[model samples]
Target: MTQPFLSIRKLRKAFGAFTAVHDVTLDIPRGEFLTFLGPSGSGKSTTLYAIAGFQDPSSGNVLLEGKSLLAVPSHKRNIGMVFQRYTLFPHLSVAENVAFPLRVRRRPEAEVKRKVADMLGLVRLESFAERLPGALSGGQQQRVALARALAYDPPILLMDEPLSALDKKLREEIQAEIRRIHRETGVTILYVTHDQEEALHLSDRIALFRDGRIEQTGTGEDLYLRPATDFVAGFIGNSNFLAAEHLETKDGASTIRLADGSLISGINANGAFSSGQKTRLMIRPEAFRLERGPTSAELAVEIVDVAFYGERRRIVARTAAGQEIDIRPTSAAMASQEATPRHRRVFFDPGAAFLFPA
Candidate 1:
């Protein structure tokens, strides 16, 4: 097998007695976009800092194309970084911000000018080149910061919650720019963010962190559609988990008894389960259908409320067992008048359901 482009081999860090990052091992191919996703203090930022040479790992190593980067200083590592803050020099113009790195390396004057222009254009900030960062809006300043980070043509770029400061719409706008820049430049990116939507939108794969350790590493679909653990199911998207008791397993599917005494078979089981073991059945909110299918399981729920949001409708429902759950169905499929406060049978394919330990 070919060697990986970037490798984090059991990388770990500690702050005094408390460990911030557990041993994290991930192999990233060249030009691949990977995000470290988790809540605050879950070690995502700490791991990124290790790769950027800001914090030294207590054990293990970070290797780029088989060369250890553990001993390299932050500035000498030649890696680019964009932080939550813009981190642009207020005194410098947008063009100068992109030129600073080139100037530090003493690149020829002509080369610096050309590279600055290219980077600014790459981020679509060429029109604001002469403006200082203080004059630009938050989103524009971030674009300037992105341009500056990419100006030096670094092989790896590290971004730590770069869009966290922006509003939802602005975050989405810059996310598109970031994706476009990645495709255009083929730069390897290791981005850190707690936003699941951001990770799903930008990453080729994701490393989900929890309590200083990596919970799982896979493509967003893998975590969303076939989560390996209960935590993963809860974190990736909106899911309704009903309490159940495992009855039997065969051919990769399991039979479970729900709290309402409903027998649901053919549910996907994540791990080994003993008979009568308590577990939870996870079904995505979008998986529920108002109409029944041949292979679908039925749930009796009373519609508590339904709110329409453009193409989809958010439903608040209560199961027979008194569990309140969320169901989001497309507006085109569910009529607002039919979704009044009345008892209804919701259908979901058992094959699409997951069973996890309670």
Candidate 2:
């Protein structure tokens, strides 16, 4: 196995009495785009800062290719960073901004100019080289910022919510650009963002953080389809959590009795849980199907709201137990179904539900 490019072991950071990050550990392979995803104040930004040497961790070590990064100065770390806000000098043109890092490193003038031009071309802003930051559009200014970060040819790139300030459409455009840049440069990237969709779209793997600790780390599909904990299941996507009590296990299947006395048979609960323990069964919005079949477990529900979302209709329904669940149905399916039924029935496959020990 190839050695990982970056390895964090028992990393921690604190502010006096407050712990910002606690016992965090991760290994990032070379050229991987890893994202730290969480809500605000979840320590994603703090972890990025620590990696960039802007903030020192209260405990643990950060290693780059097996070497300790403790003694290395921020500039000497050779890591590029892009902040949420565009941090370009007002007086400098786009080309000059991109050339700043190379010049600071005392590279020859000819090489600096060549590298700056190439970097500008990489961002598709070569024509805007002479334009000042104030004169450029928000997207253009951010492109300049990206070019500047690449100026030093850093092996690792760290982004802290760099697209959060941009409008949604522009954020998506830049997100694609960032992915392209990562591919072309083969530079390991550590991105921090609160948007789950953004993380899902761009990252090769995601580290979901919560209250200064990493709750789970996996590919987007892994986290979404098979969340390890209730927090992870709730945070990644929409889920209807049905309170259940473990009834019995036969072979590799476990039976759970829901609050309404419905028996749900699913794969065995692999985690630590005793018989008769209270748990929650996680079912995604799309897991349920509208069908008339004797084999399916039926739920009597009333359609409370309907929302059209182009490709699908968002149907909100209340079960007999008064638990609300959202279902995404295809437009064609919604159109074909009866609209006047006061009480509707829905069925879900047993394999689609996940049992979480409460």
Candidate 3:
């Protein structure tokens, strides 16, 4: 078997009496884009820092292409990094900033000049080569930072919420540029962010952290559609988790009794559930339909609000048990007359719903 391009073995980090990262074991193939996603203090950034050698792990090993990196100094590790804030020198021109890494290694002047030009062009900032860091917008400064990180042609690049400082529009614009640069450079990237949509958009795979350990890791679709736990379902996307009791399970499908005394069978169960065990049903908002199908179940709800949202209709409704749930259906599925404050029956396929322990 070919060894993984990058392997993290039982990586852990602690600060005094607190453990920031638990034993995290992950393997990444060369040139893969992986994101560490979680909320604040969840250890996503801490794990990235360990890889970047910002701090030594209390225990465990970090191996790149089979060699251990623990003893290597941060500057000697030969890894590139971009951070939440642009760390460019205010007195340096964009070209000088890009060339700094090369100059540090005492590369010939001609080589530094050529590499600087290539890096600037790669980030589409050739026109701004002479511009000072203070004159550039937040987004452009970030692009310059990206250029600097790649200027040395490192095998691995670590990004710690590099786009968090930009406005929404500029953030999205840079996301596209990052994707294009990744394609063109084929650099192995490990990014850290708490934004689920950003992770889903940019990553080939995501490792979601909770507390001090990884909750789940896979493609965005895997976590959204086949979540291993209730936390995974709630974090990856919007979901309506209704209270229920597990009645029984047969052939991997379970029957559940909802809070309002309604029975729903054929739900995709996360694990074998015993009869009479309390549980919750997770159904995505988009899964709810206005019309019922042969295999779908119905829920009686009182419409609290409805509004047109371009191609989809946003609905806020309350269940018979007084639980408010969100529902969004395509405009084509909802007629103008049906968009009103009244009692309605929402339909959803049992196969699309997941049952988890309460």
- The lDDT, on a scale of 0 to 1, for candidate 3 is 0.93
Put down candidate 3 lDDT per residue, 216-328, tens digits, no spaces.
Answer: 99998888888988999999888999999999899989998988889999999998788899888999999999887999998989999888899988899999999999999
RMSD in Å for model 1: 1.3
Arrange candidates, best TM-score first. Answer: 3, 1, 2
Model 2 reaches what TM-score against the true structure? 0.96
Clashing pairs in 2: none
TM-scores, one per candidate: 0.97, 0.96, 0.97
> What TM-score, to 2 decimals, does candidate 3 have?
0.97
What lDDT tens digits, residue by residue, belong to model 2 across residues 153-234?
A: 8988999999998999999999999999999999999999999999999999999999999999999998998788888888
Give, for candidate 3, the lowest lDDT window spanning 10 residues. Answer: 332-341
Screening candidate 3 with a backbone cut-off below 3 angstroms (N, C-alpha, C), the clashing residue pairs are: none
Superposed by TM-score, candidate 3 places the C-alpha of residue 338 at a distance from the truth, in angstroms, of 2.9
Decide which is better by TM-score, 1 or 2: 1
Candidate 1 per-residue C-alpha lDDT over 10-36 given as tens digits, one digit per residue, 9 for 90 to 100: 988999999998889999999999999
